[model samples]
Target: MPLALYMLGLAVFAQGTSEFMLSGLVPDIAADLQVSLPVAGTLTSVFALGMVVGAPLTAVVGLRWCRRRALLSFLAAFVLAHVVGAITTSFGVLLATRAVGALANAGFLAVGLATAAGMVEANAKGRATSVLLGGVTLACVAGVPAGALLGQLLGWRSAFWAVALVSVPAFHAILRWVPATTSAATGRGAGPSGAGASGASGASGARAGDFRARRELRALRRPRLLVLLALGALVNGATFCTFTYLAPLVTGPAGLAEAWVPVVLALFGIGSFAGVTIAGRLSDARPMRLLVPGGLALLVGWLLFPAVVDHAIAVFALVLVQGALSFAVGSTLIARVLYEAVEAPSLGGAFATAAFNVGAAVGPSLGGAAIGAGLGHRAPLSVSALLVAAAFGTAGLALAVRRVRARRGEPAGRTLTS
Candidate 1:
């Protein structure tokens, strides 16, 4: 992989740390702001809500300008939001900052994925995406735990300050390594010079308004593609359903001290990193194979979570397992979508990010409501199991439809994979 690809991953790491570190900071934020835990949890949902709205808007903006300019604008806004966030005392102001920061975050991720895809060989697209998205996995492992520890030692606001500071290096990496002229705007595989690039002709041809419109409409009409998107949502929803309240889940029921929270989160993050690494290879070679088994594993982990919560060793083990299983699905889902919607690169990339955030927003909101209804922390685990089960069913349906079409001697839609 190019240094530029690694730079994209680093940029995502900066954004993801800012987004996910909140999982650990929720309790501290609630205590500091004098709000209930459930209310503070809304911060996660608020950010996801911003992503839901911002991704498509960013996609449109990406289509209108040079890719580097759009990416830089988003990063600048992200840095600005965290700077303000580090100082805000009012919870309302904090919520507003999260929403604004998420808007920028969404833009970066959507454009970043498309850019990564554009940067690689056609056969190497899956690996490039995995490298880019791995930044988020690394953030979960290193950034989130570090932020939690920072919040624990200094204050929750200090975590925001740290996020802002690290973003500086990411900005410089993009400016130095990420070339200005050649990117998705020119076509996939086109580099800074824009010549001798494979796939450049197809990408340029996709710029035709009528051709792009037809491609998008055709993608929308494919129920298999839409089902795959729903699978993405459900997979993420299942992960976040338990993850949103993971701190409390471990501390309250698993009998861990508050100090151990970051350690456990770090363990989960490590598992996520390993999972994504393994899944990346499978995604390029066997996406459907990984997708089905990965979803099933997550469902089983969640269903068994309640039984293991009371045992500290078992709870810790389960946390690692669940995190790995959930994340192992990420590369597969991204690769699958890119394969299915090969024509509309921007829209496909935007949908992948937006769909995941939609689930992110839903999971936390539902977890909060369950907690408010006096269901306690473990309820979220059950919720996660149900969501994963739904994903399994949806995947089954998609497979069945594809098989039916093949049996009838009809095309099983435009599959870029076997």
Candidate 2:
């Protein structure tokens, strides 16, 4: 509920828009650049690759710097990347800009989450994390659609320009509103003179930071934890395969009008918002229950997608459920990763995020290839179904591991939910 959270949310919104708007603007970009659609599509893949490579790398590098400064610097880089992308005529240059933008994005998201957690009371950490991630939902529900409209009415370049415009406000807001506390300043070792005026405040701040750092480190060292992270990536990749081509899939086989594609995408975004909100609460309460059901829902949704594509109403309903189920697992998995790797949660969190980007990079390329091979628009959905099944298997594995560890009277890592 802090004003700082709102400011952070704005930055998150801008980042999410910049990351996702490419899906809506792919055609416009391809036409303007005079490149093949698939080639233009590589831009999204490149961005994901950047995130995969950048997440932990950025987190480690930023470890020595103040969290607020790291976040601000990354935001600036993100804005610059979009500005460069807006002006570039060469496809290669544009691709590089996107990569740079994604790298900055990785740093921003990881640092931003850590900073938000630092700002709030212990009981409010979940709420804080949700507020930060809410930016992603807002980007889907609001930012991507607006970007698509801008691309359609003005030019694709205008979409990037719009993204750039948001950066200035985010940059200033972060500077003005985000507090000046460094990881070191907030940690143990402040003298009695400084502690006396706010004794409990200083003690609590240091304890929270220490606990966070230790827990994050411990979570990263577990093998089962790594497996869970991989499962999340695979599940997401499966869904992304189908989702990346949604605009074409709906219009081509479903016989929907082109103008309605954005509206449909908006519906998916709304579903995402609902999913994230629900997932956060469920994961906080009963993560394993949420994980199993969510994965199964994804599988069911994908299996039904191909059959329902011919019916406009059915297809819309399916897409909404698919989006909701696919994204609903995110918060749960994030909490899972943090819980499992409690000693060094930041690295685990970063790795989990990197896994997500890996899935994003793989999904569309594989899906596009299937579509190119005369598999039809439905091919991607089939592939997604297979991936979701794999995800379900992984969840089962995580649960089994947890049970086995519990019975052995050993440290069973952290529980999935607190």
Best by lDDT: 1
Residue ranges of candidate 1 with Cα displaced over 4 Å: 24-42, 87-93, 183-186, 189-221, 370-376, 407-409, 414-416
Q: 1-418, model 1: which lDDT tens digit per residue? A: 7787787788788889988888779999999899999999889878878999998777665654456766888888988998888888899999999998999989888878877777777666678788878899899888887898899999999999888887777677678756565443345644544432212345563354234444554665567678878988888887887877888998898888988887787788888887788777878777767777777777888999988899998888988988888888866787777766666676678788989888888887788788889999889998898888888787677778888989999888655355
Clashes of each: 0, 15
Q: What's model 2's lDDT at 10? A: 85
Candidate 2 has what TM-score?
0.85
For all the candidates, what are their Cα RMSDs to the real structure?
Answer: 4.2, 5.0
TM-score for all models, in order of appearance: 0.86, 0.85
lDDT of 2 by residue, 1-418 (tens): 6787778788889888988998779988999899999999899878888999998877665554455667788888999999999999999999999999988989888777666655666444556666777788889899998998898899999999988887677677677756544542232222553243223345664455455455555657677778768887887798688878888898999999998787788888888778777776666556768777777777888898898799999888987887787777765676566555444535665777788888887887789899999999889999898887777777678779788988999777655555
In candidate 1, how many Å is residue 332 off?
A: 1.5
Report the backbone clash tally of model 1. 0
